[model samples]
Target chain A: MTPLDFVVSLALISVAAGVLGSLVGLGGGVVIVPVLTIFYGVNIRLAIGASIVSVIATSSGAAAAYVRERMTNLRAGMFLEVATTTGALSGAYLATLLPERFLFAFFGVVLAYSSVITYRKRHEDQLLAVSNDRIANYFNLHGSYYDEAEGREITYKVSGTKLGLVLMYIAGLVSALLGIGSGALKVPAMDGAMHLPMKVSTATSNFMIGVTAAASAGVYFIRGQIDPIIAAPVAAGVLLGATFGARVLGRITSRTIRLLFVGVLVVISLEMLQKGLFP
Target chain B: MMTRQSPGPDPQKNVTPEGDLQVSGRHRNLSPAQVAAMEEKIRKIEFAISLVLRVGVILSVSVIAIGLGVMFYHHGDYTSITGHASYKTLTSRSTPFPHSLGQLRRSLVHGDGRGIVVLGVFLLILTPILRVAVGVVSFFYEKDVPMALVTLFVLVVLIASFFLAGL
Candidate 1:
């Protein structure tokens, strides 16, 4: 294909990825990487570099709307960012020390388990009446949002602050090592452990992924892995798509979001398992 | 923080048919006017954050689009360009690109497409960090000292990651 053709096709595909990523609270790297490498015959390193750019684009683009709508838990996101950023820094160091296959397999199993749990909880109501967790109370992690689908305001208390932080750290580590956003983990942590509403969890995860990806982006840039020609179209396309996706998210029911997320998780988990078991 | 009861029925039910807006947080105990004022302040902070993100994305995408146009203009008839061995080398992992601020500046001076695109990406990367900085300011403005400190710590860790990665 011609360079123009290549760029156009990649951008189109990236737009789709961004839509799904934003809706499901993923970074879209899962889609970006495989397509770039398998279909475009791009180098793995360059594909990963492009994925990093796409993740940030998705995060910032969708977050602009999510934050404005008050769907995102800003305090929770910022507080957990401490763990994620520090974990990313450590993950960069651990990259050379640990076995890649083992890490992938471990995380894969974890994702598979979480996906099942998420599927089982798909019908459960998200808002809890009250929470007695002192750490959560002190941090004031509780939040409320106007549910467009339900046509009412939803208030919920947060719990398991410590578990949520630990999970975020792992999510960050996975993101840095795998060159993915790891929003899969972030959503589950917030939704399940932290007792946040599903939409809030997704929005908060979307809000935080950009910063997590930014932590490692500089390194990728300096290493000459980030090709501008490849990344430019991807970034622009994803940003546009994410903006549209953010608009749709508020209108949809939480059940649909969880189901979609579970589907993505299952696919990603299987992919990780394949890589680990085969490699 | 006192939890003030709403004048009407309980608001914590899973389904509130009345659609009464109940905000639960530090402001849950405040009077209706106080709650409205606090919500307004929070909305302003969120608006500021969103504005930063929106502006940053638009600016970066515009630069990237311009750079793409320049590239297409420079290398007319992209089919021929793709057929050449140079294209393969250019797309390869070993392709030489600007990897530092100084190199990026020099390339931009020469009107290089790649440099311009990378600059856009750099701006894209900076947007989230800028948002975090804005978060600290917003939290501080709200007189939420602990939250502000937490956000500052996150900012420090993000900056520290850059140095750690450099090492």
Candidate 2:
């Protein structure tokens, strides 16, 4: 493809990835990096730079609605941001040290792990029944949100605050290292460990991702990893696609949709592993 | 140190048919004064958060879109001169453009499409930082001293990373 064609193709593919990602709640960065690296034969660093920008784009766009609706737990999100941002900085520095093969392998492993976890938990929506911890209680890391579909308010108390913080650090590390938003990890940290409702966890995760991504994105920007030619189309496409996805999210029954995307992720993960092992 | 009962997954049982759910969800059984204060504070903070996110995304996407369009329009000129249409050649063959903030601004002032795209991505990065900054102020206003400090600390680390990138 010509450079113009390559750029346009990336944008169109990113739009599809964004749509599928939002539909499955995974964000476009996961798919974009692989497609750019494996399919388009773009340099991995450039792909990562573009993917990270797209993550930030989708986050900021979706966050406006989530925060405005109060579905996002701002206090919890901000509290967690401390750990995530710090971890992101560390990860960004580490990314500079790791070789391309290691980065690819790590990305593949994380993707496979995420797909499996998402698969196993696909049907499980039961909130964790853990007693509130002292740290969580002290921080008031508990809240409620109204579910429009259910048409009622669901109040929840967050627990496992220390565990959640630790997991968030890992999530931030993976986010910067892999150039994805790490929502797959953050959602589980909030939902599985912290006992937040699924809706709240997803919304809060979306809210926090932009901060985590920004921490590393700044480093990447300064390091000159971010290519504006690549980033522009990807950002615009993901933003538009995510916006469309958000509109249809509440209307769709997400189980089948989630499973289908998990399949896609599995394939992509394998491709990443093959590339890493071969290259 | 107020303690509120946690509602279950099935929200129907916790809420009354008479619409107590709205009241409960809105204030978590706080007193009238506390509820009023919390609502006002939440309203103000949410407005700020939403405004920041909306403006940031809109402005950045618009700038990037325009930049992409300009780059597409000039594709012939760029490819004709360079004899190739690959991103690597365009970006890496030259000394690579806009290594610093000053360079980006100067290029943007000259209506360079790539520079504008860089500025757009830069703005996109700034949105979350702005959100964190807003979080600090909102938390302080809510009298949540610890969270305000937490956000401030995060912001510092973020900026520190930017400087530390050189190392």
* Candidate achieving the largest TM-score: 1
State the lDDT of candidate 1 residue by residue for A153-244, as single tens digits: 87777888899999999999988888863798999999999889998898888878999999888778777888987898899989988988
Worst 10 residues of 1 chain A by lDDT: A134-143
Q: Report the C-alpha lDDT of model 1 over B8-79, residue by residue, as the tens digit.
A: 112233123465443333333356776667656666666777778889999999999988888777877663
Candidates' C-alpha lDDT: 0.81, 0.70
lDDT tens string, model 2, A1-279? 466766777789878876666654556787788787768777777777777787777777667655545566777888888888888988876876878577667767877887787688777455533343766655656676566666766666677889889989988887887676377678767866787766666667766787788788766777677887778778888887877765555444335545665676687678668767987
- Please write out the lDDT profile of model 2 over residues B1-167, one tens digit for every residue: 01112122123323445755422222234566765566666666677777877898899988888887776676664434344555556534243766577888898888888888888888888888888888777777766666678889998987787677652
Docking class of 2: acceptable
Deviation of model 1 at B136, angstroms: 0.2
Give model 1's DockQ, 2 decimals: 0.40
lDDT of 2 at B151: 80
TM-score, predicted candidate 2 vs. hidden true structure: 0.83
Where is model 1 more than 4 Å wrong at Cα?
B1-40, B79-89
